[model samples]
Target: MSAAHVISILSSKKARTMTESSQAMEQWADKLEAVARRQDTQAFEALFNHFAPLIKAFALSSGLQRQGDHLPDELVQDVMLAIWRKAASYDRRKAAASTWIFTIARNQRIDTLRRLSKYQNDISADEIWDLEGDTELFGEIRQSRVQTQVRDQLKELPVDQRQVMAKVFLEDKSHQEVASEMGLPLGTVKSRVRLAMKKLKLSLEALDL
Candidate 1:
């Protein structure tokens, strides 16, 4: 085996179980896994088709577009490229492809948000781990498992509120900083943060997170 194939064989224990993958995805997944394990193009195409929409929806929902619901297809396109680039390291045992894809889009959305602002930063698993004060519980849940639950929770939030949360946590900008920077009133910023947290808490509960 080449160095890459060697690595995949060594790490298979931590990846998702291909044996349990859905019937719809199993045959293709097996082929893709083989191609991916060997560092070939076949795996890449399969991932792009299975995960692109999920990534796009995540980016849009995480506040990629504030002007309106309309998002640039190019943004999704770029993110899909990123997905293709990163797909090789994915461990199926850890997270389903969908959860992993959603997280990628979520992170991409945050990256775009940071670019819009004047922050210099370079970047989590459990939703609770992200929320602060729950590191232990966060650790118990698998990253992939949490992503599966968290992505749906995120989908239910209002667009405006989700943007505020993303800006605060993802961008590491304070509410005051965001308010001053975005030129929104301080009261509005506080209100939005509070609302985002409340909704997030509820979502977490719903997900059994």
Candidate 2:
């Protein structure tokens, strides 16, 4: 075929893919609406079948798999239960069903992490800092002073970087969790956290001088 014909064929394929994706989303929305309106078990079952595996994978990718084999399964169950309970609140005009479901999964994952972290009694000042390197300067100061200095430096960071840093260090979210929540790539989230840490280190060192 001619080059123009190949380009035309590719464009048609792309259009078909977009159309198929939209149709799938619409079907999911319809199922969710059915559950909301009637408490339809079959509709909910369909949604569960479709989204459960996806939720499990999302939890695993966020490092929950390493936490325990059962945690990912528990997270998936929690997300699906939230969907069933909150189905009445779903607004298709505001978000697609998949978006709403995955958002619940992300939030559920964060909450799970927080609950797990609470059991750890050994978290030190350095662990709270969460920075990659050991800055001797931070070790010399009281944790309270370090916290104040870090908070001040955090304010000076660019908003994008600062938000990622807050999620990772303050909220105790994994980088993958932040990436999923913020709809950014994993590498992008990690880079933002690294950049934020470097800035924090320099600012704190200057304050110590």
Candidate 3:
């Protein structure tokens, strides 16, 4: 076969493959829109059947699965549930259906892992502190140590961030309450809190050393 003829054939095949992928993606987006607009059960089932294996493979490959673990069924369910809840928020103009759905899955997985880590941290803290110890003394010592660390870290933060952390944590105010009181955007308040949490986690970890 001539090299030119082979090159043309390969180009045609590549174009056909791209067109097929595009069509499949459009169908998926159409089904997602149907679910959003009409609560179409069939459309959802179609999505579930098509994407379940793909999501499971992604979870396994991404380290969400462990030794002897076949698939992250719970993670997949959580992602699907999130998709159902947030379907109305999907924008085709912004991203394709596969990208949108998988982004939801990725976010859901991250949130799940964070919650699990927090739960494990809580358990570890409980195990370390004698629950049976003098409850009052334990509380007092724990509160004192935490307050000292927080105060030290607060000094390290930027002035604006420090203020937000103080109002939210030290004052026992909700993020929304602090935002309203400070006249800052709620997002700014939340961002400061998240930054504070990261720094506090690091400082607290160092204290353990």
lDDT of 1 at 132: 23
Clashing residue pairs found in predicted model 3: none
Model 1 residue runs over 4 Å out of place are 1-21, 24-35, 66-71, 122-209
* Per-residue C-alpha lDDT of model 2 across residues 115-196, encoded as one tens digit per residue: 7775644444323432222334434234334434564576789999987886785444789988999999999998888888
CA lDDT scores, all candidates in order: 0.59, 0.74, 0.68
For every model shown, the clashing-pair count is 5, 0, 0
Locate the minimum summed-lDDT window of 10 residues in model 3. 124-133
**Best-to-worst ranking by lDDT:** 2, 3, 1
Q: By lDDT, is 2 or 3 better? A: 2
Looking at candidate 1, the ten consecutive residues that score lowest on lDDT are: 124-133
Lowest-sum lDDT 10-residue window in model 2: 126-135
Expressed as tens digits, the lDDT of each residue in 39-151 for candidate 1 is 66666666666666666655554455674455535557766766656656555555445545555665556566656678765552223123222234333245534443454
Candidate 1 TM-score versus the reference: 0.44
187: Cα error in model 1, Å: 17
Looking at model 1, the pairs that clash are 15-92, 15-93, 16-91, 16-92, 16-93
Instruction: Give the higher-lDDT candidate: 1 or 2.
Output: 2
lDDT of 3 by residue, 26-68 (tens): 7988999998999898999999999987777666654566633
Clashes of 3: 0
